[model samples]
Target: MKWKKGLTGMLLAAFLCGAPGVGIATPAHASAGEYKFDFGGGTVETGYTGVSASLSYDSARGYGFRTPENMRNVSASVRFLATGTKSENTFDVDLPPGLYEVSVTLGDTSRSSIAAEGVYQVINMTGNGAKDRFQIPVTDGQLNLLVTEGKEGAVFTLSALEIRQLSSNPVTNRTIYIGGDSTVCNYYPLDSSVQAGWGQLLPEFVNTNTFQIRNMASGGQIARGFHQDGQLEAIVQYIKPGDYFILQLGINDTNPKHNESEAEFKDWMRDMIRQVKAKGATVILSTPQGRATDFNANNVHNAENRWYRSAILALAQEEQTPLVDLNVLSSAYFTSIGKNATLALYMNGDTLHPNYGGARELARLVAQDLKRQGLSGF
Candidate 1:
């Protein structure tokens, strides 16, 4: 079957005028817009019998000819014109609040995946898609088109794919900025060391197309030093209304040799919270991970370790900021797994830095906390 324009024609026309060979065939008076994206030369594994592909749409970018969705009006479909064999592929499309449809055609077979698509009757900022100025549900967030094949070797090829925006609503855009120590800095020279920080892994959990994640963390820097060195200034300047700031410290702050006292540390954290809030951005506090130590068994070693973990917790409660208690969470997991089992999570013999697994786990924990508080919507 030859591909025909469906809903997203106007948007596709605007996109095509900027690019050569692409064209929109729909009339100008049509209420909705239709878009077509060709994933030529894109190969799928046919050996995997259950593999699938999807269509995705990002207001910041464009549309994903491949993605899957269960919503009635929001979905995508693919037509396999040249098939080498018989195999099934899973298909999905993620769209914003707009209406969408998906139709899959395999040789002589065809199916209309979506029945109806449209816009929301009422809109508000806190609600989904309300923050978008256009009022069209097209997501400024990520629209993932995922294809999964059950078999490892199954492969397939596509002739064409379509994405339609059936609604007039626009999507919202938000940014999240990260600030912390070396544990969270953008580690480069990828192979230099195994030291990993949760900040590096935090972006994977977020929808970057809609929400921007900026990593401003530096290695081996304390809270006061970050502000003095202009890192904080850079972060503050970019922060706008409806943005978020994640402040993670304590790794370098705990160093007594640096002459950073607990009282001074607490003051620094408070100052950061005050300043970030002044910019109208939300603040999230994260505690430092625990060192591998047994307080119950070793009195001398535990007694001499003077970092005030409790003070940070107190500030979180006093300031009413969203807190992810990594120290407490990691300690609980460490205790449950026993000293030897937990060592694999940390990097090298040092108890402070974490390995890849540890960093991933920490990121997961923070994501869980964000979900529990329902703070991600902002």
Candidate 2:
């Protein structure tokens, strides 16, 4: 996905939060002019307005296809709108100037690249029961969305589109950006997935109205390699003043394959810290939690393979940044729960990663630490 600047300084992005579950339901506090479109000229899903491909843009309707002739309705049993040509996939909706949570349901079989307001909203999301919901700022009084093919031979398909205004706007809202490894990244099929990261569940514990949680952490990431691979660049583009950057890494840095020395790890972290700080964003350094299998025979959880913890602590003091000692917090929790029960927290008894329950508990600890440190978001 690419980022583009709107006249209102709104940042364009389609950060995936979760996949399709029970379909779109009406918000309890629905805003005026909220929209729900069930595309493809078939039986409209409950609570959704039916939209056919032949329906062109009409002033009375307030929303429609820009080029109706180029679109096709392939729905027979289930509603589906498909377009093989990129130029023909344009759709528009008239929305008041504000931030809106756009929920789009894509077809299960084919992949698609969705862009709104000249910025990619959903990028290359394809799978069974695929869906994406993200907040986007609308400044031009209209939400212009384009759905194009994701890859070769993949026609763009749309099942539904729902738009609801949000109280949070891009200009005023502060975001909590998280950067780290698999232990802090989001996993797919959130409802069913056993694996999860603390970053993924952090949103549940924080105030979303004040801060948006953008978890950029991914699996198999290290201190130096994460920046080298251009992951930080994505965060750097959107991070601005009043935003908080929470960094928790070092788990993968110890791997011999990464070859990241202690000094090099600190150097890379310092680089990331300075970069975000330069953007007027506050940096919060955190020690990655200890592994589930890091306990000794005496039933005590030891901070093994966490050599970078000391460096992180030192840098937190040296840089005068807030620190969340997840290593200490998580270790104490595991020890309190006993060895057998602690092992149950991890998926398949894996030491390095945590299951959903474990991730939620870890996230709770992180949230508590943030509150203890008096961080603004908490």
Candidate 3:
């Protein structure tokens, strides 16, 4: 079989910890400004393979994964002995700032093939002060290696593979502001359990070195109320050129307390778009997530729910703003998983507020949408 080299600068160490009979030394350390973390050493039984490894930073907020900027540098190396059979393997790394390189050598005259190796550079050009963000994307910088058996009983081994970080200046930085209901607000100790919002998970997907996410969503506030109460104005004032605004509403909007009509709702959405665009910032309209109730085939509740959603869609198209169809996507996902399976994500049986898991799922979907639209980079 053919043996090739594959490596990434952002390789994770978490999975490597559990690789079969693998031993890892305390990660080698670099000076404070430039940190180095490493993972290596394991045995593979013939056809049996080793686990993929990675290293991540603890954001101290319960989010275990590290953002690109938070990741100073990463490297992965492994040595495995094959007993009888051959295996194909791939390694993954989380992308971070700096220049990266990889080298692979075959064991026992096996003549391993070097499938791939390279360097990736992430530069932040925005003037935002957040350094824990990375502008370089890791998606394109992946190395694939192929290993094959020289002879029927040939044992293939891999030696120390390394990655390094290069120094560069902090470039550009942008900000993302979130506005919505309590479901998207940050919670302190006072209202902990009841207030988990998807906005909290938004940071994970964001490359903090290039962009910062500021959540301004509050509880029990509708679209109209948010503007009337000056929350909208506050958000607008903080928005700088090249910033982005994510607006998610409709939960509290439908509440009798807000009592806004279809026309009023459309107008409000249009005005919000205009104001955001006026600031030279981009606006992304998110449809509210679906409620837990599963209307029957003939139920008209689904049709009634469409009113607000339709208005949002209409306004988005009219204003030429980007749209994230959270309503449709979440509903389809929940339906496919069934109520019982999906309930675990909701907060305290409340269809309105999402639990941490739900919030994370929502954030992932939103990020996916952003990437698809090429808006996440903003």
How does residue 249 of candidate 2 score in lDDT? Answer: 88
Best by TM-score: 2
Q: How well does candidate 3 score on lDDT at residue 256?
A: 65
The model with the greater lDDT, 1 or 3, is: 3
**Pairs that collide, model 2:** none
Candidate 1 lDDT over 1-378, as tens digits, reads 222222232233343311222122111111234434432222321211112233333333333332234211111213332221111222223344553333211111111111111211111111111111111233433223222121223322222334456444442246677778766654421223366677767767776665755566666778787666555665565566778888877778777777888888889888888888898888888776666654356221131233466776788899888887776666666666776766777777777677777777777777777878897642
The candidates, ranked best first by TM-score, are 2, 3, 1
Q: Please, what's the RMSD in Å of model 1? A: 16.0
In candidate 1, clashing pairs total: 46
What would the per-residue lDDT of candidate 2 be over residues 281-347, giving only the tens digit for each residue?
A: 9999989888778788888897944848999998999888999988988889999998888889888
lDDT of 2 at 179: 88
Worst 10 residues of 3 by lDDT: 122-131
Q: What lDDT tens digits, residue by residue, belong to model 3 across residues 126-166?
A: 11111111222123433223233323443333333333343
TM-score of 2: 0.70
> Model 1: runs farther than 4 Å from truth?
1-173, 189-193, 294-306
